[model samples]
Target: MVISMAAASAPTTEYVNMYTLNLFSLAGGTTTSSTANRMVIEFGRGNGVVLNGSFTYGADGALSGGTLTGFEEYYAGVKGFDVLGASVPVLDFANLINANDFEGVLNAIFGGIDSISGSPMSDYLNGMAGPDTLSGLDGDDYLDGSAGDDVILGGNGADSVRGLEDNDTIEGGAGDDDVNGNMGIDLVHGGAGNDTVRGGQGNDVIYGDAGDDGHVNGNLGDDQVFGGVGADTLYGGQGADVLRGDEDNDWLSGDLGNDVLYGGAGADRFLFRAGSGVDVVGDFNYAAGDRVQLAPGTAYSLTTVGADAVINLGVGDQIILTGTGAAGAEWVVFA
Candidate 1:
């Protein structure tokens, strides 16, 4: 049962309802008193929900009511059954709406601008429409920010995080993760793992931070990608971009832009293809297996312009390898 409740405006009077619900009666039980095995609150607001809060039951399965206090205390007032003729504002139960009954996966579906965290088990956390925050505490989780500009954290697992529409900030905390910035200009950081980060369709900023053999791709727009540590692979997909492979033996590909590629400290390979616009390889070390790979059947001519070697691909696209001059031809491969 998906129960969606929209928050109404504050009441004229200041009466917060600290009411206790009869779980047995609500579930249509035969006995006078019983307990609800689990309560699934759907489309709920997450204004002031803490990470590990819980509800308790008596030994006889009766509701041992707990204190539920939050932002809804001021906004979500319910009318009709009032005590002392004053309207009662519903207690903001942890603004988390559970989508499933399974023990393994905790699906938190938040409606309003809220913040929520997952359990130690694997979870599927979704920030449905608000500018919210979702944190996957510890498991191989899946997190999606469906519409609003959200903040998502893959806390300590090999997770998959997606910012579906608006400008979001995503961090893959500990394990190897796959992070995707789907639509708007986002900021993504793959932290402490050999992760794959993609800037999909916008002028995004992505970082493959502290990982070995990580992959960072700027799929479209004028994006910026940084490969923080280890042997990483970076790609500048379409618009004019900047790709930096900070350390180790990395591969940098400026696929179709008038791009700037900086092979920071490693023996890096700069890849070029047909329609790859005029690009610049900031530090191409020809002696350290740092070469340029071109697409097959690409008509190209090499020329020396002072200290740089320019591979002009006949159709107005060229790659300028800095400092190598004619010697760069030995490091250029057609494959």
Candidate 2:
């Protein structure tokens, strides 16, 4: 003797789940718990916990497959979490996603594009893979573009940012920032405030754009660097490079490879050391207190060819002072 029952209908309650609706709503809470302020959503994998309102088929609470529309507004909080098993702590999602310690993963059937943003408070954002756009809206932020070509912005306040790999674009929007293009042909800008920027590898373009002072270095590859409007220090660390101090007093050094240097305005110092390569000093203003500083214990002689002054460092190394004459000799200094 067996009992037969009719097939049940679908649950029409439209209950909330960890992946579909705010978890706080399902728990009968209006506000997030103090400990649960951020939600971590890992894309590329569509998986999450679901809480049904009707308990149909006794499936009130279970893990279910879900999708992320990328329009979900629950990715903010305080404190950090590690993604992709990397020890790096990602930015907290406060006023953005409510999950004190709640973690969610948004599965994308086909690897999707991600746009990650931060709050007015400090944030730490890591775009682990794919071409992602990360913006630290306001506050001191830490941004890491771990893989793929990425766009990272340190919106406001002092920020620490890095383009870890591939071609990337990074900007230290405001406040003092530490910007590093760790490995890529990158474009970097230290927008305002004093900044320290480094083009770690590959041919790069860097700008210390308007600040009290800036330190910009092209660490490798053929690079182009500009000191937009400040008493800035520029370095062409390796490869054939171009460095310019656009305004105010500046110190320009072509550290290696045949390089070009420009002292755009105000009093400028052209620095050279042993193995600095054959470099050029464009716009050397003698009466403007411009000076040529040489390495310590270095012996050098100067000669005037036509209207230009040439400093012979050795058999194959020289600094050609374009359009400078004998008057340039008086400003050469030993350092």
| Model number with the top TM-score | 2
Clashes of each: 2, 16
Best by lDDT: 1
Question: Can you write out model 2's per-residue Cα lDDT over 65-127, one digit (the tens) per residue?
Answer: 222222222222211211221111122222123353333322221123445665555665666
lDDT of 1 by residue, 1-335 (tens): 12111221122232211221121122232222222322322122311111112346678664465432221111222421111111111222322212222211112223456565654556666667768677777777788877889898988989899999999999989999999989999999998999999989899999999987457999999999999988999999999999999988898998887999998887888888878889999888877778888777767788999999888987788898888768545677877
- Which whole-number lDDT from 0 to 100 does residue 96 have in model 1? 21
Least lDDT summed over 10 consecutive residues: which range in candidate 1? 80-89
True-structure lDDT of candidate 2: 0.67
Shift of residue 120 alpha carbon in model 1, Å: 0.7
lDDT of 2 at 79: 17
TM-score of each: 0.70, 0.72
Candidate 2, run of 10 with poorest lDDT: 1-10
Clashes of 1: 2
Could you tell me the lDDT of residue 51 within candidate 2? 21
